[model samples]
Target: MADTPQANPQTARVLSVSELNRMARDILERNFPLFWVSGEISNMTRAASGHWYFSLKDSGAQVRCVMFRGRNSYLDWVPKEGDKVEARATVTLYEARGDFQLTIEFLQRAGLGALFEAFEKLKQKLQAEGLFDETRKRAIPAFPKQIGIVTSADAAALHDVLTTLRRRMPGIPVVIYPTPVQGKGAANLIANAIETASRRAECDVLIVCRGGGSIEDLWQFNEEIVARAIVNCSMPVISGVGHETDFTIADFAADRRAPTPTAAAEMASPNREALLNTLLQQQQSLQRSMSYKLNRYMQQLDFLARRLLSPAQQLTHKQESLAQLGTRLQNSMLQLLGRQQEKLLRLSLNLQHLNPNAVLNRGYALVQTRDGAIVRASSQIAAGDPVNLRFAEGSAEADIRSTAKPD
Candidate 1:
């Protein structure tokens, strides 16, 4: 108000402070590129629009900050007031307010151990969430017919595993899933292979392994993506990353952790020699059990045989009775024959007494009258008769004239 701006209208029209600031903003924004900056956050405010406003300051200097939802949401962590933070920002000016500010695309706590601390915090959180539970651990099959190995094809660990498995058990077949075991995309490749192997369901168990290396070289296993993949796998996973001392997040998340790749193979199969020994022991035990059972049966049979009666003794008792029967049979036959002989003698005597031929032998001659007459009582005499006489041996013939009856 003190200055006479009307006296020089051209100068008045030349530039206002706000106009100059706006022009400067356009120029600076057009020319400058995005860069990283470090400072502690102050006066931090989050808008309902999902935008963040804050002041970034160091010991003496300070800058304004704005993180839109698009960029801020990608961050896994957020910064609070009094928290030292790093920002990827572009130097730009707000034309309306004529104030310079930083548009932050990303943010991280500023410290050397920030990443490690974040990792630990996440690990503890996931562990508490039961993601790293022992109950979820699966027992490896004792004798897998087919085994899937997820490792680099050219890795020495693969050879070591194969050699060990061959030595311990030569019968099992191995399916190899060639994947990067250490590198930028190693974790993703491993996870994809594991998923594929599970979907195939061809192998009973999977071995996700690699050769030993430094922690940084084996960082792929440390990644959370790999750990989650291991946890989500349906098949039991044996993590054999690095040496015994080297552990990664994958190791904790896996169903089992092997001390070495060779150990992983050993766990996948059973030792043939041990199996043979067990079978032989079982056979021996069966033989012993059978022998004892057979001996018991034989002893029972012997005891029963001793209690049995012999056929020879029963037959001897019957034989004595048979002798008495034979004597009875012979005596009955003799009595029958004697009775028959007596009847025959009686019949002969009766025949002799009544026989006419026998009477002839007794001197009683019989005569025939053929006109031979046996003179008994009939007509003992005839007045004029011719008679004939007959003896036992001879006869004489005669003529008969007449016969008369005597009164």
Candidate 2:
């Protein structure tokens, strides 16, 4: 056969099973990028190493799937058999087993893709409008006078919240604005209830709450009207809807968010025991302060009492001082009278030395004419018609018979 195309050894290369499988895996991975695949989970197996091995099946065909522990651990809910799911995965071949498989990175419920898309779109729109701004948020009151709840009257969440409130603080009054929290037109009902509560302005704080459920069931809380109602509420609103992992648009608009219905009640009411303990401590402090002040005042009063004098004692002291002053005044007057008497005696002795009557008493006679003129010398009496001589005790009148000269 024309030497039948002799085999070219260099052109034709042989591949081992391992090499072939590896080439196939690389080709599959390169060709099929990571994309979402929707199917019902079947033959689910949770390996001891925390990895998940399962088969994704549809009406026609099924494919082996694997999710590593690191990827699956982040899911809030565990995947069970026959659960409809959507996995984001890349097609690949297991080299060791030489089998086609998909490596899953992320997963979620199947129909939730559209809901998630709508949620994201709305969130972006609201966030851009500053509806979720922190500055717009209000602070919850520390001591709410009255609490209002907007929820279904028969809901288990209501019971939990009421129980919590009763246990923590029985004195606080609770008002219920009953409404449907789910089903058709539930959003409008919830909004109306919130508006009514705001209009009444009866409660210091409003709690809008419901129990946990699937996203579709809790979708009312995600409605724009519910969110706007919460934001526009006159009283501070607390949103407590769904489980801890679940989130709704109302949570963002509310002034505060609680993880559960009971937690919301706890946030609204203060602990009775704690308030009592604080009041007791304050009372004790006031008593101690008053007691200290009273003791100080009492001691001051005692000291004043020791220094104070009775009215009778004060009168006696005044009387003694007046007696001493009177005695001093009497002595001063007596001394002045004695000095005056001595001065008078000295003046009398001086008067006696200069007295003309004393000279007459010493046997000196005074001569005078008839007209009472005194004659000092015999010449003064010469040829006088009449003359008088006066002694110390008597005066005599006589006529001059003759004039005489005396040696």
Candidate 3:
């Protein structure tokens, strides 16, 4: 340990190692003030307690740094390895080890001002144009004959949207209007594709989308030409560009904005499972209606046969015919009785289904007031109120008791 100098050992007082480190820590903290430091971050570690540990280094040297959770939690941007950053920190020494370090208070990127300014300026200009008016937005067709898509031919967004559409409603035809979604002249290409789809009028609705990227990479979707093209389109337009957090100018101008391309495809089509269930219900209802009608007609035919001949005709063949008619009448009465018994069985089952006795057969009991109003909640009765409990086997009266509210 480095300590105070003593020329004569006999006359000097010795200090412990702890005392030396304490003096060094005090001197370092007292001499240096909090200031800004610029460097590339490396060897970053985040603890379970939310504290961050890292080394900030330039070409020639490196220094240990820490940003406590309380200070760093409010920052919008997260710093990572190899990122050039400027941190405002306090220069201090760890009292235990006597090692130098900086305690970071704030952090930021080097060049965010210009892009932020451009984004704000463009947003204001578009708002003034009133291109995003709610009245101008059209409703998408619930069941479109054809769907059109405008995006890069090789984008991952195309694959996601196509897969969702195929799974939801494969019978609906899809039309692809390929365009360059980035780089030079991408905005103009997107605008022209919109215009082309409008003139053809082959599609019921159109989807314009792209994969997620940084502000510079997604700038094409934020351009003025693309927003105007969406407004001029004859068909309703949907904007599904980037991830859920990403937004673009085209999103405001379109009829609807979906967070992702897969969600956009889902919004465009109806679920197949629900449709199949509805068809099945309709079929069963039709069969029941037809059966009832056929039974009614057979009963009318038997009545007409009985009316065509009378039992008073005293001829051998006539008597035989009358006997036959009597047998048919007996058979019809038996058939009607069988149908009535079947209906009674169905009614019995329905009544049993609605009865609350089955519930009480289990361990549950019903509490009611003395006048017989069933208690549904603990709040309905106060503490020390007299009540009766009716069990599945028998009824019992209970005196005043304490009540507790449900958690």
Best by TM-score: 2
**Per-prediction TM-score to the true structure, in the order listed:** 0.49, 0.57, 0.51
Candidate 1 segments exceeding 4 Å error: 1-119, 317-407
lDDT: the better of candidates 1 and 3: 3
CA shift of 188, model 1, Å: 1.4
Each candidate's clash count = 3, 0, 0
lDDT of 3 by residue, 139-237 (tens): 989899999999999999999999998898889999999999999899999999999999998999999998886666778888889999999999999
Please give the RMSD of candidate 1 to the true structure: 21.6
For candidate 2, write residues 1-407 as lDDT tens digits.
Answer: 46668767789887899999999998998999889999999999999999999999999999999999998876667989999999999999999999899999988888998898888787787888887888998888888899999999999999999999999999899999999999999999999999999999999999999998778888999888998899889999999998777789888889889988889999899999899999999999999999999999999999999888899988898899889989988998899988999998999999998887899999987888877787876777756467787988998777677777886
lDDT of 3 at 240: 92
| Cα lDDT, model 1, residue 318 | 80
Candidate numbers, best lDDT first, in rank order: 2, 3, 1
Candidate 1 lDDT over residue span 1-407, tens digit each: 69764557755567888889888988988887888899999999999999999999999999888999987776545678899877878988887787899989777667635555666876887798787899888999888889999999999999999998898889899899889888788889988988888888889899999988644577788787888888888789999887766677888888889878988888888998999999999999999999999999999999998886588966886897898899999999999999999999999999988876777666675544555556675466454455565555565655556665667
- Any residue pairs clashing in model 2, and if so which? none
Flag clash pairs in model 1: 368-372, 369-372, 369-373
The most accurate candidate by lDDT is 2
Whole-model Cα lDDT of every candidate shown, in order: 0.83, 0.91, 0.86
RMSD of each: 21.6, 12.1, 36.7
Give the 10-residue window scoring lowest on summed lDDT in candidate 3.
307-316
